[model samples]
Target chain A: MCEANVYLIDKEGNEKLLLESVDKLVPSDESIMLENIFSQRKTVKARIKEMALVEHRIVLEEKD
Target chain B: MCEANVYLIDKEGNEKLLLESVDKLVPSDESIMLENIFSQRKTVKARIKEMALVEHRIVLEEKD
Candidate 1:
């Protein structure tokens, strides 16, 4: 239940799914490293726009 | 285990504890509404700096 699906909001205010089951977010150099339950990993250059943990949804900043 | 302790980063890069055992984060108008296990609620105007869910730590943006 701690895991969340990460979404990237576009300039048009649309949500684009980015990652799933994200269990960890580590801040890297100008980016955030996301690690999921299946051990999948990716780095994203965005801040959190919103965190709806209870809903298992995490909205990230708009794309650059 | 899904609950997290929220912290706000100060201008000096110091962490100031804001909320504990927070389980929900709802995006409001220019603010985020946080709700804890104890039913305590608060609204904060900031973006996410980091989310170390495995460590139960949620670091928010610095003060405006």
Candidate 2:
């Protein structure tokens, strides 16, 4: 499965796991839409920070 | 090979492919670090917009 675990990065460079087994990412206005294999969804005002695909990791930093 | 193809989302909601076969994403102070399987790297001043792991896709929106 190519699904990745999503993380949120803070200003202090700290990371927090936000979602797991995410299957879709859609961009809307100033936020991102996240959907998982189970069809769970979340919309957050953030940007793409990093993606560690091989490691099944993705990161996001809060927008100002 | 969990790497994903990265895309940039514009204000108009258009998607542009930015990188392919990306394996790593690191967040610096204000930019995202991208690395592919070939070890090529790019730093983009953006935030994490989305991650569609099932489709091997990731998206980013520019930060203002």
Candidate 3:
């Protein structure tokens, strides 16, 4: 199975974001394809938007 | 910040398990306290030991 923990850091550098125990990883393209599927779930979509790779951490740092 | 896309399958039919785009999500006690902060790296510890969670799709099916 796939379990992922999603987190985010806003422009304020505050780490108030923390998604405990995810179960899948949707690709960018697939994410887009599934946008409609996930549109209603803004939280999930937002989490997907804040997705990036950072030293094997898969970080989602807010860009200015 | 974190993203995660991990998949696995071994012990029956095939379905092209894919780990397209992962960002982060490693719990289980901080992945067992980082597992020595790094130990020869064994396939991300067998993909976190096939974490189980249906529906969402964190699957690593391989059992006898």
> Which scores greater on DockQ, model 1 or model 2?
2
- Model 1 sits at a Cα RMSD from the real structure of 3.5
Residue A8 lDDT, candidate 1, scale 0-100:
86
Query: Which 10 residues in a row give candidate 3 chain A its minimum summed lDDT?
Result: A29-38
Q: What DockQ, between 0 and 1, does each candidate earn?
A: 0.41, 0.51, 0.12
Q: lDDT per residue, candidate 2, B6-51, as tens digits?
A: 8988777788988999999876658888889999888888766766
| Candidate 2's TM-score on the B chain | 0.88
Q: lDDT scores for all predictions? A: 0.78, 0.80, 0.34
Kindly report which residue pairs in candidate 2 clash with one another: A47-B47, A47-B48, A47-B49, A48-B47, A48-B48, A48-B49, A49-B48
Candidate 1: tens digits of C-alpha lDDT, residues A1-64: 5788999877788878999999888754467788888899988886566676766778877546
Off by over 4 Å in 2: A10-14, B6-19, B26-33, B42-51, B58-64
C-alpha TM-score for every candidate: 0.67, 0.65, 0.30
Ranking by DockQ: 2, 1, 3
Overlapping backbone residue pairs in candidate 2 total 7
Name the runs in model 3 displaced over 4 angstroms: A27-59, B1-38, B41-64
lDDT, candidate 1, residue A9? 79
TM-score of chain B of each: 0.85, 0.88, 0.25
* Of 2 and 3, the candidate ranking higher by lDDT: 2
